[model samples]
Target: MSAGANWAGSHTYSAPAFVEPTSVDELQQIVASTDHVRALGSRHSFNDLADTPGTLIGTSKLPHSVEVIDEDTIAVAPWMKYGEIASALKPLGLALHNLASLPHISVAGAIATGTHGSGDRNSNLANAVAGLTFITADGSIRELQPVDDEFDGAVVSIGALGVLTSVSLDVEPAFEVRQDLWEGLSWDALLANLDTVTAAAYSVSVFTTWVGESAGTVWLKQTVPGRVRGELFDATRAAVDLHPLPEIDASPTTQQRGVPGLWSDRLPHFRMEFTPSNGEEIQTEYLVPRVNAVAALTAVRSLADRIEPLLLISELRTMQADSLWLSGAYDTDCLNIHFTWKRMPAEVAAILPTIEELLLPLGARPHWGKWFAAGHASLKPLYPRFDDFRALALEWDPTGKFRNEYLARTLDLS
Candidate 1:
């Protein structure tokens, strides 16, 4: 009973059992009966974050429901995809603070892995969680709110605590956004005014291949009612829709050319109806502290020739500071340097250590859901609350019912 391969087919699940229980009772029963279990969400992870040897309990079969708790919050089933939740909120005149590059990922999976969208003012997606409910290893349902002492550690549990069932997220009045594109900005200008370029819009993504003299493209998602104009560090505004990868078709991307649309439609880089990014590619990301961003980018730029060969595209985005224990933007604002690479796992894996060697020294933290070379010893010092998070996981799941190989290797929970 194989759990099949991930979205990119980069890794296959070794779990011997895959189960999707339609009801909460069924899910609890399965969780309590199984000695080792892991809740699997949309297979968007580039690594083995969701794998286990005993049972891979999927949340997709669970009911999808959204309850408006108040004007600023909503409690939704964990199985709901960000896109589905966005569609539900749009009609009610509500919207989440931000969304990932693609909305096809499950809400629980995204929160657990500390996924995020780009914005100088917005924190990572996990920060939006106001409350959470999960089935503990003993099959007891537990709920935690922002007031809970362990809430911060539990928000980004990495599926090592329990099987999440409901997630309450902060919401706000719906708004319209317009996406604008800029191209051919020299790296000299970008690195010189990096702060100004990222702060030019509500949300921005700067794309590059690291081999070129000019930055590839800049996608600006700005709140509507006003357009972003004037000096953009001498970068020329694009007249047409464009994809991050210069050679790929732009039809799959969200509305560009400064077209204003609903926040749900413009916040994400891709439309829900179309597949996001290169389906066959792998991804890796590292969050560098705002202070070290320029130095880190310079380090990677130094290895342009090595990275250019296996790269499909690379993006740099910003995130505001957060208090969540394991979040990449925990204490300081961060600049996310992301890579969408050609599916050469062996080649890509071989080159990662070189990149990590350069970036890690400058206080870079790897994205939890993406491909990374650092393990427990290398990762421990990067997070201030790393040991505390392990303690909380142990307290919640005493028998290690939810632990998996990925968690063991990354957190040294074994």
Candidate 2:
């Protein structure tokens, strides 16, 4: 059987066998017998990160189980989506520290790729992971905890190590959040007060098209009490709910206009019940140290004429430092620049090199699951633990049973 295309239809899997094992014993048998194999999750990746020429194991059919190990930690099925986990925790008065834009993404896929949400004080989703249970190359069960020496290196292994069966995440008391939107702030004021603007809320998102004087919309999700009035550095508070893309409808978005709601409901941009879009776009993202956020934005703005035409929209978000070796925010606070482009793959691919030439010099790290042209030579210097990570992958799977074409091309791991 053939594995289908990804969520955005941008990349199709070429694997000849797609199997969904319903039990851990079956999954282990398949992995042990297959010479080359990989695990597939929610299919949210835009590239070939989860594809292999051999058997592709679909994880969704695995048993859905949740266990509250203690008051502060919860262990869940690796294939469960974030939305499902959040809903399960709410009634018990617990919640994860943050959530990515789409709750529909599977937990194992998101953390393995270093995926994150927005907030100056919030660490990436992988940071919430306290422990992991993996089905390794030999089909033997292995568990890694925070106390392990190689735990940090394994957290974001990009599926080169093994298949994850369970993920233990740290949780906190559930809280309420309110979302507010502001618009029409010029680039001048924004650049000047950028620090103050991002620090104004619990979570912040800045949207733009790179074609106008106005820096575009600022969406804030706050946990503090009371209403926010007046202007945010010359940008006026919006009177109604608005989509990130100005011309599009906001009906599919989460509750806005400063309405108080559960953190699980307001943290994610899109409503869990709705499909955010028709999967008509391609995405690219780069995370740079927060100190260079201003310089990086200025560099991209210089090529606005080139990027504006092929773009659907763009967003800027912030994340706190993390210890995970391969995480974009590793060791320092980061500012991530995201682009949602028109489905013209050729045009988008052609312009990426030019864009990377400018941003890569300013200390930018490309998001693992998104489309990026930078390879091992350009990326090796950005991460301090790059060589260590490669060694870890080799140690975990010496024969390369879990390694695929993407891993070979990007990380040069055999």
Candidate 3:
């Protein structure tokens, strides 16, 4: 396959070459001989994080096996999509704690970016990782458990340290979920009771155009045998299936209307077989501490007139705190503010600094895989252990074999 644009068509990887190694042994050989290389997962990232100055190694040609480690966990190929992995686990009566908004993203890619699904109690996807195995810059395969001192930094490496090969994630007994859609919660009511609204479901997402005075859509994914249904604060359950983007057709969305189904089928908004979101949008997201969610929203709403014109829609979700060094939710529970903007690069770039300035003081961190104007200097202060992560990256790849424009700019790499 040609090295094409990313899933959002926002970033066309600029690597000199794109190759798919047939096996782990071959993958290692490629890494050992290349001066600089980067692993290309499902190409779901909206930014240039996946691009490399040298060769781009596609993981699809490597092993796609799913090895059952134990009753509580399983090891999966880094290239496998969450939807593909979930299919293998479901038949065996196992399930992951959460999936991202779309399941088409690869296991390694999602974990590297700290991607997440919605839920006040749910942590981002990387938190589910119990162990990781990767090919270091020196061509040595290294295994790391969550207990390792450097494990936290390794989990969300952003392809700075090495090329991840396999990831083991904690799993639970299979469970079912029922997704329901609700609409029209006034902007005031949403900001006032954001926590209560999120806690209403196993996972929930509130979407809006901001041009309107109220939330345009609210999706509630409730685990089977739960009661988070019906009217909620004047937001009534949608009588039919709906897409997060109101203009888009709902057929691509996962089954809804409170019909209970396997977790694999309901947790994600888009069905595995369908393209997610608009497929023509660029994304930007910031995760702020829960304590400042309301204030942050209020601050951003002041820019609604400015934002809505260039925006497609915005989503609000929650994530529990995690210990991963580069994770947006590193030290605090976060409320995610994501914009799926119309593919207008210059316009989005011009507006980002203002958003960052308003939210950064509120303890916001930009999502690693999305578009953001913040460079390493501004981002360094957000993560307390950033210097340590930088030290770790340099220690593993002292020659900077994996370093690229994205890492150089984001990590301030020499």
Compare the candidates by lDDT and give the number of the best one: 1
TM-score for each of the candidates: 0.99, 0.98, 0.98
**Which scores better on lDDT, 1 or 2?**
1
1-414, model 3: which lDDT tens digit per residue? 458778788888899888999988999999999998999889888899988888999887777889999999899898999999999997899999998888898999999899999898899999999999989999999999988999999999998889888899999999999998888888878877788898989998989887667867888899989886557887877887788886678999899998899999999999999888897889999999999999889888989999998898899999999899999999899999999999899999999999998999998999999999999999999999999999999999999999999988888975
Candidate 2 per-residue C-alpha lDDT over 77-144 given as tens digits, one digit per residue, 9 for 90 to 100 = 98999999998997899989999987999999999999998999998999999999999999999999
Alpha-carbon runs more than 4 Å astray in model 2 = 226-230
Put down candidate 1 lDDT per residue, 255-274, tens digits, no spaces. 88877999989999989999
Residue 250, model 2, lDDT? 90
The global C-alpha lDDT for each of the candidates, from Candidate 1 onward, is: 0.92, 0.91, 0.90
List residue ranges in candidate 1 displaced over 4 A.
Answer: none
- Clash count (model 3, backbone only): 0
lDDT of 2 at 90: 79
Q: What is model 2's C-alpha RMSD? A: 1.1
